[model samples]
Target chain A: MQIVVDLNRCQGYAQCAFLAPQVFELHGEEALMFTPAVPDDQRERVHRAAAACPVQAIVVGERAGPGVR
Target chain B: MQPDTLFQRITDYANRADPYPLYAELRENGVTRQDDGSYLVGTYHEIAALLHDPRISSDYRSRTHPDEAMIRRNERPPSFIGLDDPEHDRLRRIAMRPFGPPHSPGRIDELHGDITRIAEELIDAFRGADRIDIVDEFAYPLPVTVICRLLGVPHEDVPRIRAWTNAIIDSFDFTPGADQEKRQQAGLDARDAMARYLGELAGGRRGHPSEDMLSALVNDAGPEGRLTDVELMATATLLLIAGHETTVNLITNGVLTLLRHPDAHKRLRDEPGLMPRAVEELLRYEPPVHMLPQRTPLADIEVAGVTVPKGAPLILMLASGNRDPLRFDDPDRFDPEREDNQHFGFGSGIHNCFGAPLARLETQIALGALLPYLDDFHLLDDPPPYRRSPLLRGPRHLLIARG
Candidate 1:
């Protein structure tokens, strides 16, 4: 699955960091530095991180799972 | 008549054990327009939509104060959780730095061990007592202590903090015929007192730096970094109340619900790994903050074919949303393993419970420790008396057997 974060909309709330720190890294000034895609092994952690996003900014896609539609 | 204006039934003390029946009745009508012109979104889908909608404001004052009528005549500003964008964004960011990431990453998650120790200590105390009140003994102290330690609140001052927080939160009860003026004034006084106390703490930190949240706010980098005195008080007041009351309910409710449903507790005891999932279910089935009432519509918005007029008062029932059948299978039933369960135990969206990680860790270790130690236990009384608040629901006292 893949993840996407629109930095423009991101206020650096760091809620994403609270969820999945490994995937979402916040630097000084709360700027988000992150991994856009997760390998099959890290899918679980990625999904958790996505759920944790308060803004729902992190969008995740399935590699070969249920369709978004 | 549908009793449209009669919110009294919603507050019926008889419905305390299971207010779901009344909530279900409200949903049958799709929406209940109150006498005060506010709309209570009891339906599952509607609350979910409102919570997700950016236009819905979490600021309670915005919803309740039409003319910005203070919940109290003498009150400072509220925490960012009760605020809107730009300003809410700014305060919440600065506040988040010391406790959470970009500045202090993994602070909450790292407290797992300390929380576990705290839980064990509480459990150790319960070893000799055959019957105990979970609220007073375990649930109450654990969260309050953690918040105190994390925020650098003095242990001596915790009782005062608790009293102030309780006074403010007490005013949030939606009980019909409550003295509006008295409630508002008390809520205000409590908040004001909390701010003053926290401010003093912050001032002390200025001369002497320490390893605490108050000190961090005092010793910020630049103009943008520091919080004004008012801002610090408001923010600290938020943490204090949010710290003291919320998790106590979570812990108490978890134990009560589990004891109520022995099958679940037995399963959890058999498999400790399920503690986390069980906590999630507890959040859904019986959340700490049941229905957060401060969501005001930013503009006219259509939710489930019902148009919520712009600037109209909106009540986002988080509890109702969690039980929406559309969201979960047999939503009423508490199933820890129920996957795809994105419940709003904590406030969802931007203002989701900031202390969720702390709350979760505390409950997990708490329930975990109690599950085993409570070899054979049962509720002291069925339908235990509950606190007088619908927004924050939990038993007034949950006496359970140990031996």
Candidate 2:
């Protein structure tokens, strides 16, 4: 799975960072860093983090399983 | 037929108890133009779109009138919430440093225990009283005490905090012909008082570091990311006000709503696991912030096919949008087991509420503490008296009697 955060759209809510700390990291005041690829274990959290973003800035790709769309 | 004077009616103090019907009327008309030539966007999708639109500006400088520029210019430095991006984004990031992730990843999460203890302490006092004013005795104090501890402000100074907060909030009315100068003066005076008070506390924390946010803000960081004295004061004052004011309403409104809907109240008590989503539902059904003031369009913006001309003032009716039937099934009814409950309660886009995590934690803990008491308690006043500020809507006094 892949994670994409629209940085311009991000308001630094940091909610995503809290929900999926493994995938997302916040630097100083102006920067937000996160891993692009989501591991199998981190996928659930990444999705929750995306849903938790107040601005809806986090976008995640399709699920890992065979049932995925 | 057009919706005549509906905006005014919605804002009128008389309708403070309930404005959902008027909001429904507004949605029916799509994006609406009020008598003042400004617009009120009431639908869920339209409000959400405008909130994310770059053409939409939160800065008061984009306003057309002469008095607006003068009033906003003369005031103390604008809070990040009132400014557009680059500046807004920068200040918000700086402000978030001590409160949220990367630097202090566990800050808000750590407060969960403190919040629960605080809620429990306040709720414990209700055991002896024949009747309790929930606003004064419980709901108001819980968040105020929590914010005071977080900001490193002395808990003894809450009276002054209340006075200054009231003055600052009173000055924010955007109704066409409200008394601007007196309110502005009051707001400035309050700002000065709070700045001087918090500055002294922050100044002491400069050399000796502490665990609180004020200490981190004052002692830590390079000159580049550091907030200037004025900016610090403005940011601190904004946090002080923004931190507690709305949360008080959310908790109080949550209790009131739950009491009104007995089944939801009982359900919450039985299934404690539902607290998080229940709190979100409370936010949607009776949100603390009803009307967000003054978003100016940098260019002519089309909302729901209605052309909002450049420089026109648009009021984003957040509470109205939360109840749009087009967005939710049976929007008027309160349901704790709501799905896809992406609400405008904390707002959307860049200016979305910075203190939301803490607010949610505070509300979740607060309602948990109050739910048991409410099983046997009832509201003294069915539609209790409301605070004067329509923008920050809640009961001024929620009297509860033991049954």
Candidate 1 local Cα displacement, residue A32, angstroms: 6.8
Q: Whole-model Cα lDDT per candidate? A: 0.75, 0.82
Q: How do all models score by TM-score? A: 0.86, 0.88
Which docking band does candidate 2 fall into?
acceptable
DockQ of 1: 0.29
- Clashing residue pairs in candidate 2, if any? none
lDDT of 2 by residue, B72-111 (tens): 5446678788889889978877887788777677677667
Q: Which ten residues in a row have the lowest lDDT in candidate 2 chain A?
A: A60-69
Put down candidate 1 lDDT per residue, B305-382, tens digits, no spaces: 778777777777777777777667898898877665567888666777777766776787788888876668788888
